[model samples]
Target: MTNVLILGANGQIARQVIAQLKSSKAAMKLTLFLRNADRIKDIAPADSTIIDGDTTDTDALKKAMKGQDVVYANLAGSNIEAQAKDVVSVMDALRIKRLIWISTLGIYDEVPGKFGEWNNKTLGSYIQNYAAAAQVIEHSDLDYTLVRPAWLTNKDEIDYETTEKSEEFKGTEVSRKSVANFVVHLIQEPNLEVKHSVGVNKPNTDGDKPAWY
Candidate 1:
């Protein structure tokens, strides 16, 4: 069975991934790691394991990393770079490869036209923080897939496309469900997109900014 550990399990996208994985027919084991165990206790799958701890705590991370086959981190914060470093260090120490990291679009200045400018201005320092975190993952030797999603929506649909790191990011928004679907796909097919950064957006939604903006 595949032993999957999810960091930031309380996140919207991560919650969707957990639901999808639990409902799937695949033989898999899930470990949900988050800052507060009580926050997710009601929704966590009965068979899954849940741990409450900060990602920066190396001892906590090491405890969670034990016997895990894959790590999916859906974290966000100003101190994201430090979290990334800690995760990479723990995974490296345990010799457990395979990581799926959630990042945002425009990190590489890959968004085009007016939307690109708006994204840069809107995100500002937040993008810089995420970029630094992505850099840490990219520089590591682990098999990693960085998922860069466009402005997120809570729409209950799963419709999206992907762009490679080399390609310009498309569209202005994608649903959290869509991003979760993509993450589940990657986990189910572990050999796909190893060591790649992907940009995800809903098809035909291109514009200067997201509709809500």
Candidate 2:
């Protein structure tokens, strides 16, 4: 079984992803890093390991990553770049390759016109930090897939599209649930075009083309 290590397991997308994993016939091992396990207690599948800690803490992250085949990072904040470097260090030391990292639209001018404006106003400092974090992964040797999603919200659907990075993202927002399901897809397939960043959004929801396109 491919062991999957998830950082920021307490996040909304992370939790929903775990839920989908539980219901599926996927034969994979799961581990999680959560600062406060209480928040996610009784939430993971019975066989999944819930390691209590923070991703920014290098020592904790290393220990949590032991024996894992892939790392799914859902962390946020201004210090994201530094923490990502720390996690990459452990991945390097351990020789683990797969990393599915969540980033945001407009990280590198992907958002355009009014959509970019909306992302800037709402994401604010977080997008800048996320941009820096993606840079860390890009320079690393670890096999990586950076998933940049447009505005996030709690919704119930799975109709979306994917494109090469910096391409005009075609939706104003994608449900957090769709993002979660995408993560699970990576874990199951594990053989896609690797080492490239991609953009995701709801299909037909963007008028057949990005307004900026």
Candidate 3:
């Protein structure tokens, strides 16, 4: 069985990922790590373990990462760089190579046209933090895949497309469910796109902003 640890387990995307892991036939030993233990009591899978602690806490992270085959991080916020640094450090110490990280789409200034302009103007430092987090992961020796998702929505549909970091990103909005599906796919197929940054978005929904905006 593949042992997987998920940080930021209480997050919306992470919750979806947990549900997918539970229902899939993949033989996975899942562990959810969050700041609040109570937040995941009811949502975690029957066979899964849940640990509560800050991601920036190295000791807690080291303990949570023990014997894990892969680590998936669904984290965000202004302090994201510090959190990513801790995760990378612990994973490196543990000699765990596989890491799947969630980042934002506009971090590389990859969002084209008017939407790109608006996103940069609106996000300001938030996107900068994400970019820094991505940099920390990239500089690490760990085998990593960074997923940059477009503006996320609560829609249940799974329609989405992807672009490599070197390619021009497409579309404006993608459902959280769609991003979760992609992450689960990576878990099931770890070698599919190792050491790459990929962008996920709804197909053909390109515009100055997401339809909702």
Q: Which stretches of candidate 1 lie over 4 Å from their true place?
A: none
Q: What is the lDDT of residue 13 in candidate 2?
A: 87
- Model 1 lDDT tens row, 1-213: 999999999999999998888789999899999987899887788889999998988999999999999999999999999999999999999999999999999899999999999999999999999999999999999999999999999999999999999999999999999999999999999989999999999999989999987
Model 1: colliding residue pairs:
none
Residue 96 C-alpha lDDT in model 2: 90
Judging by TM-score, tell me the better candidate of 1 and 2. Answer: 1
As a whole number from 0 to 100, the lDDT of residue 126 in candidate 1 is: 93
Q: Which residue window of length 10 is worst by lDDT in model 2?
A: 204-213
Off by over 4 Å in 2: 207-213
Q: Kindly give the number of clashing pairs for every candidate.
A: 0, 0, 0
| Residue-level error in angstroms, candidate 3, position 136 | 0.7
The parts of candidate 3 lying over 4 Å away from their true place are none
TM-score (all chains, Cα) for each model: 0.99, 0.92, 0.98
- Residue-level lDDT for 117 in candidate 2: 78
Q: Candidate 3 clashing pairs?
A: none
Pairs clashing in candidate 2?
A: none
Which candidate has the highest lDDT of all?
1
Sort by lDDT, top down from the best: 1, 3, 2
